[model samples]
Target chain A: MYEGVVQDLIDELGRFPGVGPKSAQRIAFHLLNSDPADINRLREVLGKVAEGVTFCEVCGTVAEQQRCRICRDERRDATLVCVVEEPKDVLAVERTGEFKGRYHVLGGALDPLSGIGPDQLRMRELLARIGTDEITEVILATDPNTEGEATATYLVRMLRDFPGLTVTRLASGLPMGGDLEFADELTLGRALSGRRAL
Target chain B: MYEGVVQDLIDELGRFPGVGPKSAQRIAFHLLNSDPADINRLREVLGKVAEGVTFCEVCGTVAEQQRCRICRDERRDATLVCVVEEPKDVLAVERTGEFKGRYHVLGGALDPLSGIGPDQLRMRELLARIGTDEITEVILATDPNTEGEATATYLVRMLRDFPGLTVTRLASGLPMGGDLEFADELTLGRALSGRRAL
Candidate 1:
């Protein structure tokens, strides 16, 4: 429908996770209209990413070098490690400004149907860090989905024998600023069963 | 929240039309995880687009050479011209397989709020082409919105002085696959006004 390279560009843009054909066309046109410098900047960044993003050797999060910023920061409590599903989850926890601990990114949750088991994720690396770093507590910060829950459960079993290491899961309840009526029964049940006194 | 170049890649991806921050991050991660060949292919296409695209000398649609495929084809009706607002609209009309005429892309409509007017568009070039092309009919195929209507109305006035030229507009009625009950009053009124004698 368009010139050769223009159509090609649109097709390529459409391959992105959430971009539809219309959005691909829109983005292609946007790139066409953008400054050459801007386009080149994006291209340069992509080229660098293609070269590969380094992951931290300790906790398996994205890093510029062998270790991530959090792993390298001496101020953060290394004894407390937050276990999560992906590198992105590390940022989600960091955004809260509440956690003063380090992170252990598991690459992804255990989805046996998808063939992603303990061997596929960074679970071994996480366990090794806990054993060597004298980590006192492990907080399961995985998403509250089926796969996440399953991964957390498996990790609890794996960490049960680690002496003096406390394991905890994130609390689930009605979200702040959300209507109670809108909360699903499962969440409402969790909130009821996990009730705490002030 | 990410490494230097990785975060730069995410920021660049976010600049694409319709891609929000989360989608940008997802795309960035996808690119990071994708084979190097895929990233390079997309990059190569963007580079070609950044080099610049050629517009048809005759119809103002995207073209590899002096004229578009439709304008260059000898079989198309030389005496009929389809005036559209963008190159994408040419594809829309072509997809219907109903029209066999060349196109005149106005680039955009009379969007005065955005500082677009007759002079800003390809109006003068269109008039010049009509003077020399021996065109007998002009089909106004702009969009159905306010700006498209204004441009179509303006073109009608411009083409009126040419003798032997028939100016026509694409019909304004309910779309073929659309439900009449779901249509707005304006569209329903247009449908009533432009009812064909079947």
Candidate 2:
């Protein structure tokens, strides 16, 4: 352990996801040698984040203004909304350049054991959007894990009441550059079941 | 990329050593969900480090007071001093429970290519301590790398001028519990050359 604030800094940094004790020590020492300007910049950024970084009122994704840039853009297809688990998912979908529609950030997927349910997510807001925004479709782009699948199933049941709303899920198959021989059983099973004519 | 302060926070976190872009993104989102108090604590620690973390005036290691804990302890042998490259090195040696003497942190080893020389380190302070503090033995415990070896050689030449001062260097050989077969030629040769009659 180090003296005073240096050790304190290491302990604090270790709390971040994926940062082990050794990594925390390395980062702390690097910061110790960093310029005051650089350290102040990090502190200022953290201060801003702690002071309540704005989330889009409509989509629930982090935003600068009242809504996210995607929500603000007129060219985005508002009628075709993409339902995602978090703001990071929005970025991942956006990177593909295949999603031109707006997004509805669910904050997190369903995990009852972890005390996360529909009430914990933005399911009510999503229903509200479908009812009032003249939405034609909602793409369920949650992760392929248990919690994400549960959230999708719950959303499907809740959304069945609405008419003429097409619900789709992101395809699950072999990754673009993956080798079939090395594919896992679950992924290969999914690919075989969801095979396309093409 | 994210928008507003969220993106700024991610960018700032990426500046830390070993935090790549994806890791930076993950850390940013983790911090976004972390309790406000946790984030505040990190900010406060960085603030203290930026405001100028105190260093031991005598040994040049990070300290809470005018001197380090080892330096302040009256039971510690002031007649003996272990020389190290950094404060972290001091901790490494202290963990062995063998060295009960105080330490003199050199901050860094000699690396002329990086424009660091004897003046850049605590060479003058070390010399002054030998002259006035009546120190009997000085142990050179810098790293085993090229820069550390150069520093030890320079210090050896400089400390030879002292009449009764006994200067020593750490033994070089294969690490404990390490396989002799896997040991490099350099280490194997050092162990052979420095053989003892046990």
Candidate 3:
């Protein structure tokens, strides 16, 4: 609905994930009104990220170099690996400061309807990492959704062949600080069944 | 929270209007996974918009040239002028297709706390336009919010000195297709007061 360059900018911004047409327009106008230096800086950063960022060769996580920071950090427990569905999930887990293990980003979870299968993910690379690395425990920390469960189930069945390797899934329960009354039935059921002796 | 260029991209994307930290990170990762050509295209468009777009000399609206399309169009009713807050407001009024008059963008409203007074806006330009042009009617089409109402009130008082000019404010009432039950008290009051005979 705008003229020339303004419309072009809006169209480009609309391509970003979660940026709808209204948001795209608002952003474009905001950029138009902002300092020229700020816009130039954004453009420069975008160009640099597009050219520099690449998937980690070992774990499929986003990296500026061959391997991601977690993979390169020798201090992290290499014996324990936490497997997640995407690079963002790695950040989510890391924020808790609970897991000292390395991560393996699967690129995506299993969704046959969307044409994403085990082969489409980094399953082969994961298997290779487990076989070669002295990984003692594998933590399946994928989402609690259906696709995540499916992917975890597939991985558990495959990992059964590796002797002396322990496999574990992240616990499912009412979130920390959440009210019991607000907990969904499925989550409440799981929390009740998985209750541990206090 | 990310490495090098990846974090830089997220920071830049976060600067955009309505994009929070999490959304910025998601957009950054999405761009990292997207084609290099797409990113380059976005960069090129941003550069073009920053370099090319300038405010219209006639009405203060964003334009590629000195004059906006509405000001340049000879067929538009020059005798009727509609006053609005920002360049975006011009687009909103235009979308309604109810008015064929030219526009005079006020740049902003009269916010006393923010130190934005009449002098800060394009009031001088608006008065100059009214003095020079054969404008028969001046419609105050500012927003329905507090600042917009203040601006409209200020303009109405200012325009009173000009003889042979019909100054009017846009009618305030319940929005079209909005349920009466959901309408706020102020809006319901305005709707009742402004009710027209069948």
Candidate 4:
């Protein structure tokens, strides 16, 4: 019952993850009800990101110029580079206020079934950064899934012979707020397997 | 390390509904790692939606101009208006290809606790449309929840005095594919309370 632009918006919104037909329509209506100025701001920022944003040549992170903010930060620990399967992992880690080191964004985890391999990722660039920079430690921060484990294993083997390079993986355990009884078998199993000395 | 623009994109992605901290970072990284042109396209569309869209004056559905296309169509049955709470409801009805009438979007349902009242809705415009137009029947297609019920009741009472106006509400009960046993008590009660003879 709407104009072409409204329909176009609904179509576009439906493409987002978890936004079904009904939800898409709701979002479209929300946009329609909102002030044009506010909507335009979102559009403008998105447009700018679309036109001007790009990947950092060094570590495969998004950037407007040549390097990403974290990579360029002078205060970050250059010697400790955290490797993650995706860009979102970096943000999650950062939000915790725990990490003050640089990052290397691997486009994706090692999905053998999906045919993704070492060549598909920016592995060569990661090796280059490790070789040239004064990086003393490489932290594997990929997800706890099979693909993540495979990727981590591959990286560890690849960097085994490199001098002065210490490879470490993020610890796996039960979540802080989760109960021991309700924990899934796999997670509880992993927590048990990766147990540490007191 | 990498660049700052990628980090900015991740931060923005985190703000979307259902996008967790990790997922947001992943999407941002994916966009950064992908071709610049693709990322730019998404941003451009997002920005354009924010800037270029608005609600239709007559129907409150999303539109590029004064009225939605359905409201503007001369051949549509202005006499049979389907009233819904949101623009998304319009789409759901449209998908069925059954109704041949126009629509009146109420912006939202009645929620007293939330402080929403008749003043907050486009009730004036709706009444005006009914008064001026040759509307004969109205279908109240709001959801079955309390807010939707209240909105429908409010409309029914508001339009009761209009001459030759047939006010009908959409039936509520079990979904077509749903198993009766699995249905919650409330839905089962509605199905029983609204039962009809064959």
Residue range B100-126, candidate 1, lDDT tens digits: 988999999999999999999999999
B74-132: candidate 4 lDDT, tens digit per residue: 98988899999887788789999998999999888888899999989888889999999
Better of 1 and 3 by DockQ: 1
Q: Write model 2 residue lDDT over B1-198, tens digit each, in one string.
A: 799999999899898889999999999999899888889999999999999888998999999898888889999999999999999899899899999888999999999999999999998998888888969999999998899999999999999889999999999998999999999999999999988999
Clash counts for the predictions, in order? 0, 0, 0, 20
Model 2 lDDT tens row, A155-178: 888887789999988899999999
Pairs clashing in candidate 1? none
* lDDT (Cα, tens digit) per residue for candidate 3, span B1-198: 876788888888888889999999888878888898999999999888767587899999988778989999999999999999988889999999999999999998999999999999999999999999999999999999999999999999999889899999899999999999999999999989999999
Best-to-worst ranking by TM-score: 2, 1, 3, 4
Using Cα atoms with residue i matched to residue i, what is each candidate's TM-score against the true structure?
0.93, 0.97, 0.90, 0.73
Better of 2 and 4 by lDDT: 2
Question: Which DockQ-derived CAPRI band holds candidate 2?
Answer: high
Name the TM-score of candidate 1: 0.93
Minimal lDDT window, size 10, model 3 chain A:
A46-55
